[model samples]
Target: MLGKTVKVVAKPRRGTRGAVSPRAARMVLAGAVLAGAVAGCGDEPIKMGAAAVVGDDRITTAKVDRAVLDCEKQFKADQVANQVRTALENQRQQQPTSGEPADCSARSAIDTMLNIEVAAAAAKAAGVSVSESQVDRMIGLMSQQAPAESIVVALGMPKQFTRDVARMNATQGLILQRLGADGNAQSPATLQAQQQALALFRQTAGKLDIKINPRFGSFDANRMTVTPITTRLSATESGVR
Candidate 1:
């Protein structure tokens, strides 16, 4: 989950394991911050490791650790109260009991983070960079999309929402701005911006090195380890429904 930079867990490059290089962590974090700030909600508290490589860059374990922490924090801060209320409604029904179930929304956040990381790496390789003006433009767009009051209530803090959103918008803006200037698109000046975005979207995606781990679900970029759990009911417990 992307959020404010609380702390970074940086590790050196290793040969045996697929952990990320420290430099890549910095770049990925910068991009992730721009893409999706963590909202912190989940149950079962799944732990994951990042070892996927993007060309020469690695997506270190530290990044995964940080993401989990941020996700947990956001879960408590934003979703826990609402979830508690919902759970109460289902209390009367016989329900399966478990820790926290996997969060599809959080999974989407991880996907966004990976995309930003890979895109930032590709942009760097292409010698593209972002400008302050570009960041401002992104912030402007976010301000329009997420009104100050809604964000404040969503995040539980007015300043936190504004400041974090500003950072996310600015960083993402830089990426889009650079993509526009790289001549990735062929169009008249009026439509060049849209074309550039499309070109970048198509061109930069396949560049990353991803390995999926089946334990986590359908998409696994790092090939992290997993152990399946199974429980079978006895004949009496399994009486015809």
Candidate 2:
């Protein structure tokens, strides 16, 4: 679901009572790129025990661990599990693996954190702002199709960060609209708008001086995802004969 480009659905007007179509909700939720395994690069060495560095902010491994734990706990709940199962069935998707240590992996948690940071930066660069009310409204609209927790879990995000995910979705939607994305997501105009938004994200992310620890993975600007480092050894190993 991540790392793949998808259409961005136009947000429903405020005060509208209609629910967002399931297809639209899925597209919007899955639009963000997911982390992949690849080596990362940075201008300087990352701090010890840090997962990744974004601009002046250092996301610690502890934080990622906590979020992963939260996700795991949420996945254990009968309510959450039932909601997720129903939503997946509606979408014709498979169920999550049971007994996994953590439903959200460290790599994914870090990647989601990175995406939130980058999305905020991109919004600022574009001079776009999404209010808490807007985020709530978007969530409300999505809730008609599926509960917010289900949507968050399905997207591999921590349930606690539901608002953050909603805000990012709203902000990106507005940015794309400003970039000339018509209401029709399948149109050529919308495709162009998505490309422009991607460029904006790349540009803003570049200025943030992001660096990922090798223990986890590296950030790939082209794919805008955190990828794992390869373990293949060199011809001479250790760079010396």
Candidate 3:
């Protein structure tokens, strides 16, 4: 899949006057795109040792390693090291002993990869898809509205990571539509769709049996995404040898 090329183009972002919180948006649309490579849903072989397992597919550790390397490159591309260090320091301050600053970018890389897995699984089940334009626009919008926070919290993100978030964004609306809810924002129908799709995300994530290599973190089913965890553990994907 990494061998295939996908075209990307820049477009105008939505205005920054809206009320959508980026973290809330993360809740609404995270994990997607990467998991689209899975051949089918459930009980499939993970030929490579996996960094994560989402339903039938393996999010291979090799893939994660490559992603982390790419993210590191992206950081150097934009001089994000200082910002990342600061964010990690803040997180450490809150915990006083946990969340190593060195781990920040790595954790984000791994989390982004896992979210892509969740996204692909949920989108497949709902029969919806996300496009590059959607991803670009969403990332662009967040960047326009909250550049500081974006840099501090989500530094060194690859375009594919945003692309995955784009999928998650699209999947939420599509899942809502599939469940018979209209796409109107903030209306009753939209609310219903959001609620219903959130439930579907939970269900989808539960079925994926997602396992994180302890070196990275663990999956949080309530959020249907991976969260930072320092506790070391073994790889637990279903088909890994």
Candidate 4:
């Protein structure tokens, strides 16, 4: 699946009163977007300098590291495949280059990993819980959606990547589900909860003196410039890549 592209438009501050700090808003939103990507719940631990305790569960560096790796592998393989395909398409006119592609997969994966950790923490604080079966289904769907070429190799996928991804998906779905239930498409409670959660995220982010690492993604306006955040897409549907 292709990655989603998110467009973030920063409104310029007029006078001092009109000037709300875009930096803080951007940082908080960036955190939220990143959390959204990794909220795919799984039992696997995400690598942490210190084990991040969420309720009774402890997220390990190994589990999150693996998940990040899987995504990285897939993304890099896809990039390579795209390059090859482009070269092959022009092969009749020119020869293809014989050089290895830069590995940015790990960076992307790490971003996802960090986002998930933050989001999971928020979830725990909000008292969100998901079922194992729900997690299973999400994993199955992601596995089915994986690119065909990368499916064959051992590209960073553990035996349990599928299950872990599923758990993450389930967790994300639960959060979204709580925000919107039934086919009506609008729930006052869900909206209120979303607002509350967003506020909580802002408050939490305010407390952490964050330092942005630029090696991950580009931090263009309206896009995820950091690792934990993925680009938001224009599609009305949920789940980008």
Best by TM-score: 2
lDDT of 1: 0.35
Off by over 4 Å in 4: 1-104, 143-160, 181-224, 227-241
Residue 7 in model 2: lDDT? 27
lDDT tens digits, residue span 32-75, model 2: 43222111358456677677888788889889889888876776
Compose the digit string of candidate 3's lDDT tens values, residues 172-232: 5556678767644557766666666666666776677655554445544344334565444
TM-score for all models, in order of appearance = 0.39, 0.74, 0.54, 0.42
Candidate 1 lDDT by residue in tens digits, 60-136: 54554455555445545543222322332232132332112233132333444455554455456556665656655
Which digits, one per residue and each the tens of the lDDT, describe model 4 over residues 143-220? 342322322112223233444434544554466556553322245655555555555544443343222222223233
RMSD of each: 16.5, 8.0, 9.9, 17.4
The candidate that wins on lDDT is 2
The Cα local distance difference test for each model comes to 0.35, 0.62, 0.48, 0.37
- Residue 107 of model 1 has an lDDT of 39
- In candidate 1, what residue range of length 10 has the lowest lDDT sum? 36-45
Off by over 4 Å in 3: 1-48, 79-104, 129-156, 160-162, 177-188, 221-225, 230-241
Error of 3 at 196 (Å): 1.2
